[model samples]
Target: MADPWSKKNPFLSMMLSGANAWAGIARGIMSGQAKGQQAAAARQGNKQVADFWTSALTGGTPKRPRTSKKRR
Candidate 1:
């Protein structure tokens, strides 16, 4: 039996292929953003934990960071 729905039409086949490529690109972009967000959240959580430990070690007094003053 001959397949009537074969990809004989070049235009339709190209359109379908283009759509599939676009969908894959979109999925990759979304996954990348999600990974970035997860990384950011993990960094923030680690900072919070470090701050808590610093405070605990310093008897609840968080030390202020020293800044350089410009001489006039």
Candidate 2:
């Protein structure tokens, strides 16, 4: 006969193992996807910021400037 206090609870045992496994699987998938998304967003944001700076520094329609003479 099984001891009264040490008796196994079938419901908790069944749910615990599968739930723990599922939690690990979900965490891995979510974290992997989250990391990929974060990397993509960072690259896109950096490219956009770099493009803005490049245009700000170098992009303009070229034009001729007037000459000035110094009078001493």
Candidate 3:
């Protein structure tokens, strides 16, 4: 009592398989892009914080660290 029209044919099966593969690839690409953006934002934030602290400690402008003079 199986319906002949409901049966899976080769072309239909191939198309469905291709669609699934495309979906999986898209998901992977989207997740990787999100992760890369997150990492970049974190790096930018860290740099800003470091700059702020450096300027604050150095009295507005950053300066080179003082080196100790050796005895002659």
Candidate 4:
């Protein structure tokens, strides 16, 4: 049987790539490197996720974000 953890396994490779991406994002956030636009973008993404779950569970509309201004 083929090894499930081998790099040739597409599913494992995809999962590893996602993990690497999350690690980079976490590192940036922890190191204070995700600044200004990056930080705002991250916050917005997180809010969207939270809103999605909240609305889904409560059967309510997702809350609007606090800011709509475009980041340069």
Candidate 5:
């Protein structure tokens, strides 16, 4: 029997959406780094950027990033 939920699981979809958000965060980090910012700062900023969507996607709480996208 096929698992009907594969069609659209909110958790999976939210995670995917979070992935898209992380991609933006990565871009922000890379741009900040190319300009010579501290690694720790970049990571902290990235976390904040990622949190924007993660929090929205997974209730008001921040969720861990699932995957990141490449600039294209």
Candidate 6:
């Protein structure tokens, strides 16, 4: 006779395995989202620093300034 409490029951074993699988999938998704957000924040910070240095070196002047024609 097979014990009801044991993993001998196919239905009970399948249900338990399915629950564990779902939990693992959920954890993976959450972890991936967190990593993506961190990477995005790092990229934004690097871009800001680059912009600051460029402006400081260039004295905040436009690359091409418009010249108005002088009428006599």
lDDT of 5 by residue, 17-43 (tens): 999999999999989887775677789
Candidate 4 per-residue lDDT over residues 1-72, each given as its tens digit: 867665387787899999999999999887785467788999999999999899889999758879978899
Overlapping backbone residue pairs in candidate 4 total: 0
Residues 1-72, candidate 3: write the lDDT tens digits. Answer: 999998879998999999999999999999999999999999999999999999888878747898799779
As a whole number from 0 to 100, the lDDT of residue 68 in candidate 4 is 78
Query: What's the best-to-worst order under lDDT?
Result: 3, 1, 6, 2, 4, 5
lDDT values, one for every candidate:
0.94, 0.92, 0.95, 0.86, 0.86, 0.92
lDDT of 3: 0.95
What TM-score would you give candidate 5 relative to the actual structure? 0.35
Where model 5 places Cα greater than 4 Å from the true spot, the runs are: 1-6, 35-72
TM-score of 4: 0.36
TM-scores for all candidates?
0.71, 0.64, 0.67, 0.36, 0.35, 0.66
lDDT of 6 by residue, 9-40 (tens): 78878999999999999999999999999999
Q: Distance from true position, residue 50, model 1, in Å? A: 0.5
Q: Which candidate wins on TM-score?
A: 1
Per-prediction CA RMSD (Å): 5.3, 9.1, 5.5, 18.3, 26.9, 4.5
Worst 10 residues of 5 by lDDT: 32-41
Candidates, ranked, TM-score? 1, 3, 6, 2, 4, 5
Positional deviation of residue 3's Cα in model 5 after best superposition, in angstroms: 8.2
How many clashing residue pairs appear in each of the predictions shown?
0, 0, 0, 0, 0, 0
Cα-based RMSD of candidate 2:
9.1
